[model samples]
Target: MDIHAWQLWILAAIIAGSLEMALPGFVMLWFCVGAVVASLAAAVGLDINVQLALFTLISVTLFAASRTLFKKAFMRNASTVKTGVEAMVGQEAVVTESLVEGYGGTVRINGELWSARPLGGPVAEGERVIVEQVEGLKLWVRRPAASLEVPLKKKEGR
Candidate 1:
């Protein structure tokens, strides 16, 4: 049983395409395209060196040229969907334990309790604070601006 070079190239293309699907990011797609082009070159009676060279060139060119396009099209939109602790930023949490200045306490956000520290002054228990940043098992929080506003004075004698 004799196997042709083009058949091997097609197999490589299939494997690369499958790998691209299993992995994250747009990494292996260029190699899949390159293998397809190499297979076509082999079908046309091109020399082994020529087929290999074309595969390398096509893959590198597509990877480089499409990098920016892929980043703009795909990576840009991905930032809009944050996961894990990153999503906690800007969310309001009630202080479960009084947070001393420069010290950490507990806060409840999304039904989960988290160790938190104040970004400015200390936060009292039962006060609402906004998550500003997250640092390994701790959240930096600040009081909401509206809570700091002064109330209007009532008119003298009704």
Candidate 2:
């Protein structure tokens, strides 16, 4: 029982397209395109070796071309609908605990408790701070410069 070259090429195309669904990002799409091209070559009576070489060349070229174009398109259409830690940036939250240098503290953002750090000063408990950045599950924070005040209790005690 021998399978025709056309049948092999069609099978490759179907498998490539199916794999695209399981592992998306347009990676397998170029292979599927190549397989289709190979199938057409087979229909035109091209030898199997030529068909294979053509498939490899076409797939590589298409993948490179699509990757460049996709990146450009993706960048142009990007949006900031924050999800996860990204959403915490620019949000205001009260320091639930003091953030000592080299130590972690906690803050509540969007009703969720998160590990936080003061940018460059001790953030006393109940001090309002704005999230400057998020690294992993931790939030970097600072008192908005305009709202900063000297701590009277600390100054008097020193």
Candidate 3:
């Protein structure tokens, strides 16, 4: 039985492709493409050195060229994609329990109760607070700023 160079290249390509599926980042796909190209070169009776050079050149060139495109396409909106606790920031919640100074209480947000600590003075029960930050299982909160409250206007004549 004779083992061929193209067979090894194809195996490498398959392994790289599998790795791309298992990994969390955009890599290994370029190497898989390069391996496939190297296998094609071997099928055309190209020298092993030439096949290796082609594989390295193709992989590196694709990796470098795609980096900027990947960043622009995927990372451009990264800041806008907030999830979990990060999305809780700036959200309004009703205090479920009086939050005493130097003591934490609970608040309800999004129909869920969360441990909350006041950012400044005490927050009374039923008061609306804005989530300022999240630390572990607790949320730092503050009374809604005056700007967020709408002032009632008096009638000119009653």
Candidate 4:
């Protein structure tokens, strides 16, 4: 009726796995793998202290290895495509309201009027601007260079 060391190590692994699911940090699961290695050490009749040391070494090494894998699997790459409003950057927009330095205005980008601010000097209404950044519900814009500007035809009345 005596519980064996390997059985205890296996139980610890199961507990670690369950805790990983409940907390979900993508961290504790590495310890579960270490516990499995410890169970193998115990099955071979290794000393308790030796099993503990092996567990610690296995867990830390696996964690380090996983970080590189995670970077390749989850992190952005140079060829990655952006979606949503993030896709608006570098696009051209029209100022719907004049933007004074340090003050906010409105711009129409992709057919939507968004609160906007200029990165440098003020932008006048109906002027063309380029989207520089998108922060929260606001936009950061800049005037297109002179070479990029197209002269607007004047209305007969004004």
Q: In model 4, where is the ten-residue run with the lowest total lDDT?
A: 71-80
Off by over 4 Å in 1: 1-48, 59-69, 72-79, 147-158
Model 3 C-alpha lDDT per residue in residues 46-145, reported as the tens digit of each score: 9999999999999999888888988898798676768888999999999999998787999999999999999989999999999999999999999977
Candidate 1 per-residue C-alpha lDDT over 44-130 given as tens digits, one digit per residue, 9 for 90 to 100: 999999999999999999999897887887798574678888899999999999999877899999999999999889888999999
Candidate 3 structure, TM-score to reference: 0.60
Error of 1 at 20 (Å): 9.8
- Model 4 segments beyond 4 Å from truth? 74-88, 97-124, 132-158
Write down the lDDT of every candidate, Cα atoms only.
0.93, 0.89, 0.94, 0.92
Error of 4 at 1 (Å): 1.4
What C-alpha lDDT, on a 0 to 100 scale, does residue 3 get in candidate 4?
Answer: 95
Give the TM-scores of the predictions, in the order they appear: 0.55, 0.51, 0.60, 0.58
Better of 2 and 4 by TM-score: 4
* Deviation (Å) of 10 in candidate 2: 7.0
Q: Compute the lDDT of residue 66 as modeled in candidate 2.
A: 94
Q: How close to the true structure is residue 122 of candidate 2, measured as C-alpha lDDT? A: 83
Q: Compared with the true structure, what per-residue lDDT tens digits does model 4 show for residues 104-126? A: 79999878999999998998999
Query: Which candidate should be chosen as best, given TM-score against the real structure?
Result: 3
